[model samples]
Target: MGLNHINLVVKEVDQAVSLFADYFGFSLITNRNSKMAVLERSHQFVLVIWGQELNRKDEIPEYPENFHIGFYQEDEGAVREIYNRLKEVEGLKLDSEPKKIRNTFGFYFYFEKLMIEISVNPFKENIA
Candidate 1:
């Protein structure tokens, strides 16, 4: 079976919701007083963001160093388009410009404590 959804716990649920909605084309499905939100893309991928309360400790969740969420683009140009758009957003810091990474063309950035990767698959033909 394929993956269904992903849940992320962050310090600010509303901010994370906005980032996903405004940039990644995820539409808000439900929002619970800024403490949690459910969003879905046109392809049915669901992303759930939860505030610190979800942990029951009121502490901000920390992700492992290499842990990140990735978004695949159709081509290098699409990857660059997203990179350029994110650059115009004040306060958002991109790790670097889109470039060759392993066999893919992409870049990485952080929104709050979550790392995000936007890339174009170089081995697209290899996948079914």
Candidate 2:
């Protein structure tokens, strides 16, 4: 079977929802409450964001050093377009401009505690 959905725990559900909806083209499907939201992309991918308040601990969640979620674009130009748009966001910690990273052309950045990668693989016909 194919993969279904990803549930991400973030410090603020609304902020995460805005990032995915406004920048990544994800449509807000529903908000379960102030603590959770569901988003969907054109390809039927679901992204669920859960607020940190649901956790038993009282601190921020920390992912492994190199752990990140990535989105692939159709081409380098598409990747660069996203990079440029993200650069204007007030407090996003973008690593740098898109460049060759191993076999892909892309860039990385942190939104709150989540590290996200936007890239394009030149050799791949389908980027999904």
Candidate 3:
């Protein structure tokens, strides 16, 4: 079987669900108040967003440096398109403009507590 769902713990489930819906076209499958949500995209990819609750304040979760979720576009232009779209979102943190990184053209940005990377295809050769 192919890959299944990905679960992310975030500070705000409502905001996170909205972000995915607005930017990635994911639709909400279900929501448990503001505490959690299940989102689906492409009919196969499932994303779960979990929010902090009062009782769970003692536990701390951390991601390693450079840890991020990446979205790959077909080419450099598509990557730039998403870059521009995200730039218009007020309060979203964009680390930098899209630039050549290793073999891909992309940029890094953050939404709330999550780090995100957007890149063009990294396997192909001679792509600008």
Error of 3 at 59 (Å): 9.9
What C-alpha root-mean-square deviation, in Å, does candidate 1 show against the real structure?
1.6
Candidate 2: Cα lDDT at 37: 94
TM-score of each: 0.90, 0.89, 0.86
What C-alpha lDDT do the candidate models reach, one value each?
0.88, 0.88, 0.84
Number of the predicted model whose TM-score against the real structure is largest: 1
Cα lDDT tens digits, model 3, 64-123, are 787889888888888889899999987689999999998778999987757998898687
- Candidate 2 runs further than 4 Å off: 126-128
The worst-scoring run of ten residues by lDDT in candidate 1 lies at 52-61
Ordering by TM-score: 1, 2, 3
The TM-score obtained by model 3 is: 0.86
Across 1-128, the per-residue lDDT of candidate 2 in tens digits comes to: 86789999887788889899999889998987868899999876899998888885656678889889998898999999999999998768998899999988999999887899999865686546
- TM value for model 1: 0.90
Q: Provide C-alpha RMSD values for all models, in order.
A: 1.6, 2.1, 3.2
- Looking at candidate 2, the ten consecutive residues that score lowest on lDDT are 119-128
Query: Any runs in candidate 3 off by more than 4 Å, and if so which?
Result: 58-61, 124-128
Candidate 1: segments with Cα more than 4 A from true spot: 56-59
Kindly give the number of clashing pairs for every candidate.
Answer: 0, 0, 0
